[model samples]
Target: MSTQQFAGANDRFLRRYEYDDSWIVAADLGVADDAVDVDVVGTTAIVVVDTGDGVAETEFELPGTDADVAVQNGVLTITVAK
Candidate 1:
């Protein structure tokens, strides 16, 4: 599978990038650690963001297996086994 496969969800807060063997989901600025949450439920990747006003979320059906989720530098990177 390719990283593009992980970018099925379209939202204004998140940007998806395809890497050599990983998929990167970048959270927009102003999204703090406490404001955002990411999870991989089976083959689906769910991302929730909460600001002072309200909460927003996005979900994408991932590709491949052995999925891993990592957040660093204000970016969420999901690597999968394919």
Candidate 2:
């Protein structure tokens, strides 16, 4: 038998992202690898970024079955394709 337990992995923050052509744009999170994390939760993509002052979280709704997450030029980008 397997026991199911919650890992307490709840979304600490919620935010919205700007939608572009086949992509979602998140806020600029400055530069710090330790302060940034991207995760795919079910059908939504989550981005967490901390800048010493506070943490910024952004979520993008995926439109398709696949998603690709990346950070470039201090910005978080999520690409979704159908």
Candidate 3:
């Protein structure tokens, strides 16, 4: 398992876990699911979240180029192909 925490404008954190054929990246952002947006460029994943007060953005390296993103219960989950 790989874990990383980013300190920026807001309290944001990222966690990654290695699986058999894929990697799981999770971000804990206490916001609505519709307020989170994710985009992938090359091996990097860019995450943008609307925090009501303002917008917070962060980018991190992904294990692979292809990624699937989802948000649930204020948690952002991403699965990358490896």
Candidate 4:
């Protein structure tokens, strides 16, 4: 497995892991599940979160075309096929 770190807006960080067949990206935004939004366009992944104080947005390169996104316990997890 391989790991990568991405610097995000507001100094937030994203952790990425690569497995045999998939890639997983995760971040803790300290927000409710309903307050997060994720979008993928080609090889880019866009993440937007409502942090109560305001909105935060970030983007990073993705390794795959298809993605599955989820937020729980104020953590965002995105898994994509590789």
Candidate 5:
């Protein structure tokens, strides 16, 4: 099977295309912070996870309130699509 690189995978896309605005700024969802880290070696993106820290990430493949995700307290969360 071939792998498709989503816009999220590209660093440029994340910094420029996806979340690009001057005056008007958008929330970094949950997984879009320098403090936060992620690893998508296989296929990942557009997902949401309950950080339990009063935050929620975006959802992937699923609509509205559904997305594959995981969360941690100290270390990074590992998200894999179901």
Candidate 6:
């Protein structure tokens, strides 16, 4: 999944990336390429930014108000708060 928008004058360039969770993981070993990290902390739900690092530290969690969700450096982090 990806999206693009042109805020510049002529949109001389293209900005695109992929976004999907069909088969994803979440976690971190250290500072990721994007400089942030996020994980569900208990299960296997994790969201990464730009590390090319792989899903070894990620966890899983349901998305809801009780989801201790957070973001750092560009990654979405989910924790067990409820």
Query: Which candidate should be chosen as best, given TM-score against the real structure?
Result: 4
The per-prediction tally of clashing pairs is 0, 0, 0, 0, 4, 9
TM-score leaderboard ranking: 4, 3, 1, 2, 6, 5
TM-score of each prediction: 0.62, 0.55, 0.83, 0.84, 0.22, 0.25
Candidate 5 TM-score versus the reference: 0.22
Q: Cα lDDT of all candidates, in order?
A: 0.63, 0.57, 0.83, 0.85, 0.31, 0.39
Q: After superposition, how far is residue 4 of candidate 6 from its true place, in Å?
A: 41
| Residue 23 displacement (Å), model 1 | 4.6
- Higher lDDT: candidate 2 or 3? 3
For model 4, residues 1-82, the per-residue Cα lDDT tens digits are 9999877555767899999999998888877889989888988888888878888787778788898888899888989997
Better of 4 and 5 by lDDT: 4
Task: Please provide, for model 3 over 19-82, each residue's C-alpha lDDT reduced to its tens digit, 9 standing for 90 to 100.
Answer: 7788888878888999988888989888888889999787888889888888999998889888
Error in Å for residue 43 of model 4: 1.8
Model 6, residue 68: distance off in Å is: 2.1
Off by over 4 Å in 4: 7-11
Better of 1 and 3 by TM-score: 3
In model 1, the runs with Cα more than 4 Å from the true position are 1-30
Model 6's alpha-carbon lDDT is: 0.39
Task: RMSD for all candidates, in order, please.
Answer: 4.1, 11.0, 2.1, 1.6, 12.9, 12.3
**Pairs that collide, model 6:** 26-46, 26-58, 27-57, 27-58, 43-60, 44-59, 44-60, 45-59, 45-60
Give a tens-digit lDDT track for model 6, residues 1-77. Answer: 54442332333222323245322222322344455455544444555444465433423334333345555544443
Worst 10 residues of 3 by lDDT: 2-11
Leading candidate by lDDT: 4
Give the TM-score comparing model 4 with the true structure, all chains together.
0.84
